[model samples]
Target: MLHHRPAHTPVRPTPRRARTALVLAVAAAVAGLAACQAASSPPATTSVTPAKAPADRPDRGARDGEAAGHVPDGATVFDDALPALAHLDPALLAALQAAASDAERDGVTFFVNSAWRSAAYQDQLLREAVAQYGSAAEAARWVASADTSSHVTGDAVDLQQTGGSQWVADHGAAYGLCLVYANEPWHVELRPDAVDEGCPEPYADPSQDPRLQE
Candidate 1:
């Protein structure tokens, strides 16, 4: 004879334990989603150079040794025959290059004997001239004060008088160059109007230029 048995059922977890398990499952799902999103995201871009502060920013309009028409550094002697012209005013240099080309066409080679000089160099020259001449007045005739020197400003160039200055003196006016001082035939400056109107009478010397009187 067989005996009847009641159906056996598994016991469910207690309410507290069931709630805890659901909470853990939800938390694990959320964490997994966050990790997947992170893995799919793009990497951040890192710059090699740090951004400069406003005070450390570079001047956009300035170039090496030339800020607002400041004189450039002298070029090395090994560079070119007219290397000194590298330190001269742009307008003056352009005029000189044109004049030199024209002179060369006529079988003359122009040369720059002197161009820009630093303030320190100009001051040293002034001191040497004063010592050699034994008077500031006599020195002033040859070397202008650094404060007023065209060389310091890169506005003047001295050419070899024998050929370069002689050639330029004859033809430079056509290119806007003019001998600037009556006593210094080798010294020239840009006078744009001279291209068509001719150069004005030169000052007697550096001492006579009003810029040097002070």
Candidate 2:
């Protein structure tokens, strides 16, 4: 006898299950699109602050000199901006200015190399001279003590040698300006008597000056 076989039947999904499957597929596609957009996007930027610049400081040598009443190079007697020229004794300044004006007619210019100085600056110069000369006596020949220095008192001025000293040497007596030191030809002081009489003989050096001796 032959045996009989049962036929296979196809199974269909329920409506609820079909709906859940469709929703899962749509959710997966949305998640993939979001990931792709994130990957293509630019990176976030961070803000940074710039560093500050350093403060400016003046040259030590120049600052020190300026503070000590040292005038700039090529300074003239008419430079009222500089204390070295402006602080000079009134009588001395007037004589120098008058002589300088007349000197211009002769093609000579008066340049003041050194003039009024702070007492501290004078003391510093004396100390430096002593160190350079190796003795107080040798230094005294060039630099005087602050107490006795005419520069500190604003009664003396040192002129540039180029045209100033020679012109002053020739015409200074007429204006009451006279050289006070034989060694320092550029140094001048006002002596009213020099206008009528003449400049007295200069001391050989500061060392021989009677005023410095005191």
What residue runs in model 2 are displaced by over 4 Å at the alpha carbon? Answer: 1-64
Q: Per-residue lDDT of 125-179 in model 2, one digit per residue for the tens?
A: 9999999999999999999999999999999999999798888888899999999
Top TM-score prediction, candidate number: 2
lDDT by residue for model 1 (84-190), tens = 55677888887887777777788766655668777877887899999999999998988998899998888988776657788767788899999988899988899
**Which segments of model 1 are wrong by more than 4 Å?**
1-83
lDDT measured at residue 68 in model 2 versus the true structure, 0 to 100? 86
Give the backbone clash total of model 2: 0
Error of 2 at 137 (Å): 0.5
Please report, in order, the local distance difference test score of every candidate based on alpha carbons: 0.77, 0.90
TM-scores for every candidate against the unseen true structure: 0.61, 0.73
lDDT of 2 at 18: 90
